[model samples]
Target: MWDHCPLMLMRKNFVSFHVNLVFFQVEDAQGREATIQRLADSIAGPFVYSVMTLSAITFGFWYYFGSHIFPDVLLNDIAGSEGDPLLLSLKLAVDVLVVSCPCALGLATPTAILVGTSLGARQGLLIRGGDVLERLASVDHVMLDKTGTLTEGKPAVSAIMSLACEELEILQIAAAVEKTASHPIAHAIISKAESLNLSIPVTRGQLAEPGSGTMAEVNGLLVAVGKLKWVQERFQQKTDLSDLTTLEQSVMHKSLQDSQSSNHSTTVVFVGREGEGVIGAISISDKLREDAECTIRSLQHKGIETILLSGDREEAVATLAKTVGIKDKFVNASLTPQQKSAAISGLQALGHRVAMVGDGINDAPSLALADVGIALQVEGQETAASNAASIVLLGNRLSQVLDALDLARATMAKVHQNLSWAVAYNVVAIPIAAGVLLPNSDFAMTPSLSGIQELSGYGTQKVTSVDLVKLEMTDFDVILGMDWLYSAMPQSTAEIELSSFSSQMSLF
Candidate 1:
């Protein structure tokens, strides 16, 4: 009895297992079919309307005109008695008119550009429009100089050593006077003060001398901060004839001459009290960004040739470029804005699309000349460059350059996809329109021609719709504009996410 009971339980368990397997198999098969059906429906939904509209227009023309008017026109007496030479000519003219290129030249190029620009914007790269974006993407060689493009434009006080007074006190007084000035040097001074946690006194009155420094009233003291010569001159005017020793007079006189020559090259800050002598001097230097080397390598990895053009001395430019691992090409030693422009034009004349990245007033001309001009966000001439440039990188980080390049490449790929679709559609449709596959073919124009006509119209209409979506994404309502996103994320992640989002939005 026990043996029989065990056998019955085993048989019951086997039957239950078999029943569950059958149920699951049925459910799995149904789920798979449902998935396939959903996919088909989703794809067919948009295309159905496209095909229907195209078919209606094509058939309407063929039935109302092709069947009624065209054959009659072909057989008319005006056709020279159904075979006259003049009538044949007239018929040919009509056929030619009907087949005249429907692809509007004015509309096609602009539409492509509109699509490309929208795609670029979605990738966190704000391109002005079609003309500029096309030109930028086509660029081959890029010339990027180290200084401001690959370095922080703000030159900090690297080593503020005091010659006469307390170093911190000198920085504090200078920062106070500079608080009222708008020069880069002034900003560097204030930044240094803040870093040192020194409290700078509020300025009462301030006056800036172009190419020199500034003079101001801080905490009820007449503080003059400028080149040594200017400060010495101010002190000389206020002091008596014998206030200074012979050595002091000689040093002051020599400093003034040197100041005049060095004014264009170096920035020197001299701080002193009213009717008194010089206290201390602070020298600041612009340092390259920490990631400049890595950024250059990233560009090289993408097969883009990097070159540097700078107004700085040749030795300095070479040193900087080499430090950043970009030593193959560099033009140095104080190039004028026109010279920079000429260099860009010359490179472009060689059939290379040149991209110039710069951050100075002198760089504006070159930026305009280059195929694609990129300006760093903190650059002093960012506004002018941004207006002229095809792209603008908004951040102090040099690595942002790599991000911009990746975005450009991806945007170009999307443009290529669009171009390919346009060409492929034409290749397949033109032969059918010419009636190439007509006689003795069951698979005739009735189905495929209708499909072609519908597809073309559908594509054209969808382009317009997609363009609107792109415009909304690119031209989103915001003050800071597209830069906010690029500023917030790493260049790589931002670009990848942007590309994915754009592709999805375009339904590519």
Candidate 2:
């Protein structure tokens, strides 16, 4: 009754082809009817029909030979009748083909990655994919290089000293001479002048030398502002040093001492009647971020280890770290870029997952070398590092790092939940597929048994022999991804929670 079964196979293949076409059509029908209709029309065309007919014919031939001709041939061979040995080999080959398909492993891994990446996007952290997220979550320690990372990149005048003049007068003269300069020290002087509401007198023929203070005519006075050395040198060249007072000597001595201690290449000024006597000096240094202490403490509470890596002096780095509550485990005092990368690699080699957060070109190599790299957006030097980083913080606030860490932890948790559900499904479905509990009279597992058996045998059975039937009853509900998580919750609320928790700890 089953002989000449090409029509039956054709009917089965026709149904399968339509079922797949319908499944794709439904998925593609994302509020776009015209596009979906075009896709559906393509699936119903001659090319699809031809492929289905060919597949049906191939399946029919394999079934016919397996149930009839091959078995008869094997039996005749055992009974010593003349039968084809090649026919038995072909039948065995067909039987093996019927039991193994390659779709299972091919479909599973990519699907898992897709789901993981989609979930990560919902958390406001866009990782390239699951592989990147997995790598980010595993970071055990973070090396935050100083300079632009821990402090404002710009330097401003923090302190100023004067003797024979008001502080505002000293700032005004300094700002007038330093106005045309682009150096950080110059900016600091100008900023001080602005804050004090000091009017900078416009200077004519302003000249600035590397080690010499800037010289300008402010209100027709030869105004000079820089190191005492430059001022004294210019002064002695044209003045009578024998007439200098004790108080002038003391002020100049203190200015010299400050210059040496600061290690700042100083520029001194000689303000006189057509350049005869020296007047004053101004010093500048880089400013630390106002929220540095708060940011450091927040990082500690999240269980993220922090280390400062910098090219600044050991004393300076230590002082800042101590002020910010960061520990003494930091690297300080003029580290080369190669040394930074080596340090990161060393930590990684010891089985510590290191994240290097930086905002400088000097950090690019180390950022690339670390397990996870984070770059802040506001720093211009961060461009190269940002490109290399697995994550880029859009704002200058270190609190954003805390935000990302929270989101990453949340994303990872969701990944675990998804993995657990997927594993559980397989564990429960596999046994029922193998008929482990079907014989028990207490529970009738038979109705579910057929579906489970078919699912389990998906790759084990011939792709053509397995009925391509849709089992809507067995489909699991859609699991939430990271996008859904973000839309459902308030990010501001999360930030507030983090802030409150941080205050309670005071670890920073």
Candidate 3:
């Protein structure tokens, strides 16, 4: 609730922002079409109209024919006054109409949605609505974000290249100077220093320039940490830093090698002290999560195509893709946010239902544009991504993506089952109640049976018109417990083994 306060304020402002605009045409079309769509989508919609029509036909039939047929039955069984034929016919027709409960039809899907969402919440998956589940069941392709989604967002310090100075001294000065910056690389250095239990010294006159670097006076020395270009530019501006050019060249040479390694791409940060020249460079790289590879494989085995979409360099994206077992053709690299959105649109144009998983500001537009948008709710995730997403992955696990797909398909199946049963019940029983077989004495059904059929379809007895009253609150939870959906997923995903059953239940 607290997390959504900003969005609530935005909505409040947005409402007032658009108050002066005339949207008559759009609103009219939306009003008419939305109403029609809502009515169509309601589980009991068709059934209710069918029941009304059947009730009128039943009334007309008995009103014309009851006088002849019911008189014989009542005379044979009763000793008291026989009610007027018209009144008896009207009563039977009303009974038939009233007992055909649309409430059960309405309650069926909503109940499942409520239970499913609540169950998902417990499992750290925040499904926005049942409509998302409905759409997820049709998704044939999944576009994944490389950072944060597949790999742990946190990058750790890998190696330090020091010039003449011990690596420990370089780290201490860098950590101390970087303490004022909140960049990912800064955090990596600080985290590494803390892991080594090194004390970070207090700095004076600290200044940080966005996209440049951070500089401060530490232990009476002018210490700085940042990108190689920014650090070099800073060095050129300082007369005392003239002697640091050779050291800077050495650090750059080593950092280039560390970055060019085929294993994975790494970010490098340069460190310098005014009087001592260049200190060293620190290498930081994000590591893949434990379940990332397995999750990608699991999704692929289900015949759901997996695509890696990232703004990272092609080499880096390719390395992560290879590590995760994603096909080369599906890997998209160095894409701007708009390009990512365009890719999603392209796939959709090809008649593929797409699900995009991302966790950053750049991914927000594509996330919103995808058929089903899934955002990994990691610590410090951008607000835009979360707001655009239809489903929020609170646990930040790729494996949970599989769980969501399985649950969505299962929930949709339940909806179909419920709706089919309701339609079949009305189709078969309505004719019987209308006395369709009354002329054939051999198989003619009695009035008691008419009432019985209606009530039985409702799965209840003692049903009154009140029981058939439109269910004011048809929404019900379709609880999909972790164990239930988990059991339904491939055993390879559950057991972490290769098996022939992996493709049995594809979400597509």
Using TM-score as the measure, which candidate wins? 3
User: Taking the tens digit of each residue's C-alpha lDDT, what string does model 2 give over 59-118?
Assistant: 454345433534443343321354444443343333223222223322223333333333
Please state every model's RMSD to the true fold in angstroms. 19.8, 20.4, 13.0
Which of the numbered candidates is closest to the native, going by highest lDDT?
Answer: 3
TM-score of each: 0.52, 0.46, 0.63
lDDT of each: 0.54, 0.51, 0.65
Model 3 lDDT tens row, 112-155: 45445545554546677777878888899999988667877677
lDDT for model 1: 0.54
Q: What's the true lDDT of residue 100 in model 1?
A: 24
TM-score-better candidate, 1 vs 3:
3
Judged by lDDT relative to the true structure, which candidate is superior, 2 or 3?
3
Ranking by lDDT: 3, 1, 2
TM-score of 3: 0.63
Off by over 4 Å in 3: 1-50, 65-84, 161-186, 193-282, 378-384, 441-508
